[model samples]
Target: MSRQRVVLSLISFLLSFISFSQVTTEVDTTKIRIGEQINYKIKVEADSTVLVVFPEGQTFTPLEAVEALKIDTTKKDSKFKLSRIYKLTQFDSGSYTIPRQKIIIGEKPFYTDSLRVDVGTVEVDTTKQKLYDIKPIIEVEKSSSNWWIWLLVILAALALIGFLLWWFVWREKPLTEEEEIALLPPYDRAKLALKKLDNSQYLIRSEVKEYYSELTMIIRKYLDEKVYERSLESTTDELINRLQLLKEGNQFPFSKETLHNLETILKRADLVKFAKSAPDTALIEMDRATIEKEIESVKAVLPEPTEEEKLLDQQYKEAQERKKKRTKVIITVASLVLLLVATYVGFGLKYGFKYVNDTILRDESKELLEGEWIKSAYGYPPVYIETPEVLKRVQDTLSDESKDKIKQRVFVFDDAEHLDIKIITDEVDGGEQGQEDIQRRVVQSIEKIIEEWETKNVQNIITKDDQFITPNNVEGSKTHGTADFPIKGSDETFEGEYAIFSFATKEGMIAHVTLVWAKEDSYAVDIAERIMNSIEMKSDEQANAEQESQN
Candidate 1:
């Protein structure tokens, strides 16, 4: 279902709930004016995830909209429930018919009967009364209630300041003993951790795994803190990989032997901790002492200068000299795979979006173009002033960017329901219009629709304002547990997202449109863009003159 209808359906959910596994439909306000606001709510209570649809004709839509549709899904104990509130309204004052709406859930679609309402002409008061004929009630000026309070506060503040000055004249601040000691990190603590290790009575108690794990942790934490500064609490494989990287980068003070000992100790500790194996205390003490010695030796010397390092350096130098010889076979293969995926997704999206954007438009436009139109000299640029006071707002928002590129275009489909489609020309590139709408308009519409959908759908919405993705916070679709992408943009074209949906309107004249959004690398968008760029838009009247000349 469309987002607007989803919201209206939510209203149906809240007000009418039959049972946990069932659906009950109810409407409180049967009558409404053509363009006035009215409220309706529907609710659903279920045990599992359920997809629902609202009555086909009644939904939140712009121009024919009173407010954005609101879908409220609430969970109670083990039951999953959804609620929708629709602020239904119309634009004109006239008797109108609302068709029955279908609600779908769990592969089943339920519906509400068609409802009718009476709309009367707007009532106005023609009788005008004198502006100041009524006797004015005399008002008395009350005493200043805050004057004394302000005076007293100022006097108190002045006295406090004066007293503080006199007190500071003889006052002194002495540093505490604790303040003299600087804060030290785990690395600094690790050097002295051997002392803590000595104090710990591990051998006395039979906490074998705990004792060994703690010792290994101290060693790993020390190496990470003092040497590489990675979190050693991470998995053993991660620690080994990080250590190898450090070895390669010459970013740590450790030989392969020392690293091997550390890894052996850590792996053994993991085994003892998880496998419930008892470690020999005597052997552990001996290994602990050995670990201490290795740590000290590594501290005295930097990364081991093995022949392997020299070989690596020599290979790097040779690679640089003969750079063109290396094709990076691994990366080349990965790039090919990525390109294949992009091509597939791009092509699929292009078809999906084309069907949504073009076929419907063509069908609708055909109905409206009855052959003749008045020459529109009044037509202005096919761009909308999206930002009224854009420069000032952009200047305030971004210090790096001086101004924003805000663009929009409103196309009037001849058939408002099904847009006229299938425009052809002799050459493939030579078409009157593209299969899709303008880029800026697409981006803006998609962003708005997604934001609205989020508000209506996600219970606890956290709107993110920035676009840059950092490694630490990439939150890939898989990582997020949901596949919804945040809206993104760049200056060239709003080339960042997929939130807008192209859909047909009730009027059929407005088809494949509503909140139509496109994502980059989408085949539909790419094809539509290629076709659109080839064709230039002109007023209807200019087309007649061009058509005659061409004929």
Candidate 2:
């Protein structure tokens, strides 16, 4: 019984100790403002080490992050204790739920109830649960992007206003004649411009082309606009020639040295501009100085006249006048020659007898060479060819003119497509010794040969002239306003004033022609070919038909 009592007592003591060792937790406050840390303490008198798990979003919203997660360790005799301190804040101003969290004490689970936080706009007790927040910066941004631009715009507007105000005042106030004259820049302004050039630091740095260009222009423009009124835009050579009329001297504004230097610069510039040459720096620099001095040398003085100078001036004026007159005369003569050759050449010689310019000649073309034959612009005009010269080479070559009967044919044509022809003069004129004589002689010779021949016409020779005639009677031949013309080929009486003349029809065919007449004296083969080649008979139907039949 004693032993039993001892064991029971021991068991009771062990139970008391174990029950007392269970861990329990208590919180100082259930909720607090942001940054006011709440004290949560866990009291335990346990035998083994304890581990705790903290809630994630339940403890703090992600955006309202934990500032600090600190572990506090303390020792009590031989026991180890661990506690966590979380420093947390919320950027949001709202009531939020802290979700219930689990705490395990040796596998016995305990859960804390959900807590609400009230963050207010006030200072709080930090020793307790205090809320502290950084105050917003109180500064007002002073914008340079704003008032500065506005001020600048205002300043510009004010400046423009001021300018306009001043301009209106000045402009509205009328100037007396003398005052106006005073306002006019003096003639010495040219001198001032040159002085500025001489003193310019821009020149020393050798901005050569610029310096020379400026210098030359000032002086040249002064001459062009004020003195001679000539276009200095002209070539340097032209400018010099113009100024050469003024006179030569130191006082000439264009002194010899200055003129020469200006000439050199202009010429060098021309070489660069036209000849495509690039000048060396040294030459450019020298030219710059030369121009500067030239510009400076245009002083206020008059050029003097001398007897020799006056004579030369007069002579030059006369020469220029004569040249102008000569040019006009040459142009006139050229135009006349052009008109004269226009019709014969199928274009005016004046471009090919652009006789379209002459009203009279346009109306009556034959009037061009109606007078007695004389040497003309055309070489050896109205040249006559003897019958013997026409046949000189062909004389022996001719099949004895006696192949029984001499068959000669004349077909006048405008186109070379067929044996087509045109008749300019189908009547006969008896020969005499006058303008009429030469013409009739040229006509009758052709008619006599065809008229007396036993003529044959194989096809209808298309004579294009309105007046076509059979190569028959002299006075009785078909003439004008009718188509009586025939293509003649045959034997006998090969003589008289019938000839052919060929022309360029410009109708996609070789020649425009007229069956004409000249005397028994024959013309050159060139003349004969001229007539024959002019007549292009249509493609021979008989021959073409034969070809088709053969095919």
Cα-based lDDT for every prediction? 0.47, 0.45
Error of 1 at 177 (Å): 11
**Best of the candidates, lDDT:** 1
Residue 484 displacement (Å), model 2: 93
TM-score of each: 0.23, 0.21
Model 1, range 53-92, lDDT digits (tens) per residue? 4432223222133443445667788777766655666555
Model 1: ten consecutive residues of lowest lDDT: 420-429
State which candidate has the highest TM-score.
1
lDDT of 1: 0.47
Estimate the Cα RMSD of every predicted model relative to the unseen true structure. Answer: 34.2, 53.7
